[model samples]
Target: MSNLIDMCNCCNGCSSRRQGYTLKLSFPKKLLVATSVLVILAMVVMPSEARALQHKIRHERRQHDAVALTKDARIRQEELRRRPHRRPALLPQTKDPAERLRNLEAERFKNATRTIQKKLKNTRRYFNEERKVLNETREYRDGMPAWLPTINFVAIHFHTYKKQGATLSERKFAYVIPKLHKSLKEFLEIFDRLYKVEVDFADDPFSNYNRTRHELIWNTTRRLYSTIAEIEENMAAVNVPEQNFTPSKSLQALEMKVDAPQCLKNDYIAFRAYGNLLNNWFSEFKCPHGKKVTTKNAKCAAYEAKLIEKKNKRNKNTER
Candidate 1:
């Protein structure tokens, strides 16, 4: 065993000597190498730990900010909910019966006129197209009959003409309402008949003229019904008795002649002319002249003006 140990030691010495050096570390040198390795490991590990800490801190800060914003929004909404709501101020009630009646009539008349104007505009549009299509037909293109009753608004114009101290009277409403209704009824019947019958155009088999004719009659009929209702309501408000009247014989005769294209054209022209007359009558009757009557909420207007002033001040400050 002693000899085997001696041989191994001799072989180790020979290998070390062949390498020309034997690495040897003292206690201090060993400590220094260990310190360097520990510093390198710390340099790599500390940065990752710091980065993780920073990320955690940023996430927490974002969560804190979000919570703060939510709290602020809740507070604002609560404040708004606690605030009292305000109602708009209204015009004082007028004591004069005549003045009140006048105002009511004026307001109703204005609204009716606006509605009539809108309907008339739609009627005019449809009428243009209807006229165009009708003109294309051989019968209409040939010539309208001279004996056919053409629409003339001269009588309606004379009736609705503005006179001194003129007001909406029961007499005026009574006379106009029945005539308007009769005209509308006649026009509607004509349109209903035409809508069923195909126009004399082989190229327009789908009845394009009938379609436009339908639109014109529909708008005019609506206008007629609306005007009648408005007049009735106004009469009721003013304590005026509603009078019953039949359509005139002339209007009946016109209705009977709807079978002819010339009569249809005349009826359309009359419908449009009557619509214009009604529009003008409503516009001119009991309407305030040169001055507008309006009711404004003083408090609301003042509040709005104050807000605008504050906004302007804020903008100026920001610019500065």
Candidate 2:
């Protein structure tokens, strides 16, 4: 048993020595070897001692820039062009109507002034004649002659022009429905609070009226009026009457065709206000009542209704 134990101890000592030789003794050298290997690898990568590299013969080449990736660094073709000019993509959009209105007014005034100046130059005689003719027509129409009621006749005539039915004359209520609803919602809130006497403010519509100015009314006619006005003013400065105006019918009308979405907003407000205005106007007149005897043209509708009434009576008589 002692001999076996001695042999085991010897084997254990030999194993420990082998482990030390393989692991601990070689550890420092191994570390040194690894470091040297890393240094050699690093040297190979940079190759500072190696010869300078010749120009690489690439198959194809194209110039590129990291800056070209930015939005403005790009050229806008017809496909990419959205508006009048190139602008930063990240800008917050602005849609202030007041700002737009001011710009519109300036443009409109310049345009109208240019037009009047042009008319003053070109067709002075004709403009004078037309103004006189309009005045005479107004005078003639104002008098209720023994012959006819002019205003009613003219209104009827104008109304008769709608062969397309009432569709064209009917300003679409649906278009301004959103605004109407908004106003109605507001009105309901006001009504509920009116009895409580909580708020000091009272609603006043007339305070918002713009003075009857041609420029203010016409300003929203088109884009960047000052740009056009600048051109017009320059032409006028050079005594170029012909250059003062364009030949387009649209240009003559001084139309302020608002954007559909924008028009919806404006017309919605217009509809509400105009509805009130019309009511007030009509109420003040204290007229447009009493048709005891039917008038000339619409008497046909009444006659037809009367005939239907008589026919119903005759049928009842016969049945009885």
State each candidate's clash count.
0, 0
- lDDT (tens digit, per residue) of candidate 1 on 1-59: 45433444663353443656433532466889999999999999999999999999999
Local distance difference test, each candidate: 0.50, 0.33
The digit string of per-residue lDDT tens for model 2 on 1-320 reads: 45433444663454445555333433575889999999989888766434333222221221233445543546555436755235323333349876565555344444443443343233223322322221122222222112110112112211223233222212221112122223223322322222222212323321122121112223211211333344345444433342122132322222244333332233233323323322322221212113333234354334435445666776799899
TM-score against truth, every candidate = 0.35, 0.15
RMSD per prediction, one decimal?
17.1, 24.5
Pairs in clash, predicted candidate 2: none
